[model samples]
Target: MRPKIYLYGDSITEESFGDGGWGASLSHHFSRTVDVVLRGYSGYNTRWALKVAERIFPPVESGGVPPLAVTVFFGANDACLPDRYSAFQNVPLHEYKQNLHSIISFFKKRWPEIVILLITPPPIDEDARLRHPYIENPSGLPERTNEAAGAYAQACISVAKECGCPVVDLWIKMQECPDWKQAYLSDGLHLTQAGNRIVFEEVVKKLKEQGISVENLPVDLPLIANIDPQDPLKAFQDY
Candidate 1:
């Protein structure tokens, strides 16, 4: 069976395989070598994610084939302010940390051989988010702020360290790019084309550091160039 890479998170992950999305890039990178499965739910915070974790990622023993790696990306919605417009999605900082730990522990207990990569929420662009047409408060600022998201990002990093998992510090790395506000994020939360590339690169880098050799994974089938048109049966004869 082909190895699988599972992506679990919120809208950012839900849309990760969209046009120019990071997940899509990863899929293309692995191609026939791995199955990139996305389990992202829009607008979900870590609190909600924890409740549904088992439903989405069941024990490996109960499944057909175990995943090679799983990425737990959350915190954007958790960073929502506990105010009128965003309270519905708001999760306390302490709870957010706990939720992350629970998610890591769940996967570790179920599949100890699986590699877990934690991704922190990217920085928010309040100005762009406020200008977005669907923003909660058209006349006011956005429900999420850069500072608030940064706090959660830090917590995510801390969780990774405690859990001994690899991490993609999207929040910190994206900011290192020049004019990241315009280049990385779309509106305030989601990633743009450039942002997606950054995420894809970082994810691969982290996986590599953890001794997961993506480049060396076996291809799913023989190369087209190696197939002989004269003897198509020759390809299947071995099987």
Candidate 2:
């Protein structure tokens, strides 16, 4: 039985233009491996993602919905500081942390054996911060700077550790390849096709390096735990 994988996150994950976004590109790696379900939503945060996770992986609905592994990506929308991005603002760090903890706890409670991976949002445009003026309005006072983006990424790692969740550190990867602006990102935050491909490639490389092929695997496999955080040979983050 092919494993069912579900992705839950923001607009980037929702763009299923077949390999258009990172999640779409990641889907291809599983084309010959397992069944992939895309559940990316636009303008979403941890609170809503928790709801989506509940709907997708309802508790005790055996034989009703097939077993599926889940991966979550947030922070992009959460960074909208001061709760002031046009109609939204940055999610308070405390609130954001609590919301994330809720999502992880709920999933762990529902499916203790399921794989729940967390991915931090990619970098925001530094020199181009002023480009997205939609963030501030006449009444909106600036709350945070773009440099603070990485701080949230760091917080994400901490949250993963707290939940014992597997993490895919896209922030560091983008830093290593700083020219991602020309290579992968079009809107600074969201990834371009090439960028998505880069993310997918790394995901596949990590999965294969762990000896668990997504191809034709059972849902019972702990795809999350199968990945060792203490292992140095495979991931730079782990090392």
Prediction-by-prediction clash tally: 0, 9
Candidate 2 Cα errors over 4 Å, as ranges: 16-19, 59-68, 83-89, 126-145, 206-211, 215-239
TM values, all candidates: 0.93, 0.76
Candidate 1 all-Cα RMSD: 1.9
TM-score of 1: 0.93
For residue 121, what is the lDDT in candidate 2?
Answer: 76
What lDDT is reached at residue 166 by model 2?
A: 73
Give lDDT tens digits, candidate 2, residues 1-239.
56566777787677744556656665665665566777788878776676666676655445544434567788777776654443364676677778878888877787666667777777776434444444444443433344556777788888989987777788778778757666766666667787787667665665554344655354334445566677733533433
lDDT (10s digit) by residue, model 1, range 116-161: 9999999999988887735458448678889999999999999999
- Name the 10 consecutive residues with the lowest summed lDDT in model 1: 132-141
Q: lDDT, candidate 2, residue 59?
A: 58
What candidate 1 gets wrong by more than 4 Å, as runs, is 61-63, 133-135, 228-232
lDDT, model 2:
0.66
Question: What residue pairs are clashing in model 1?
Answer: none
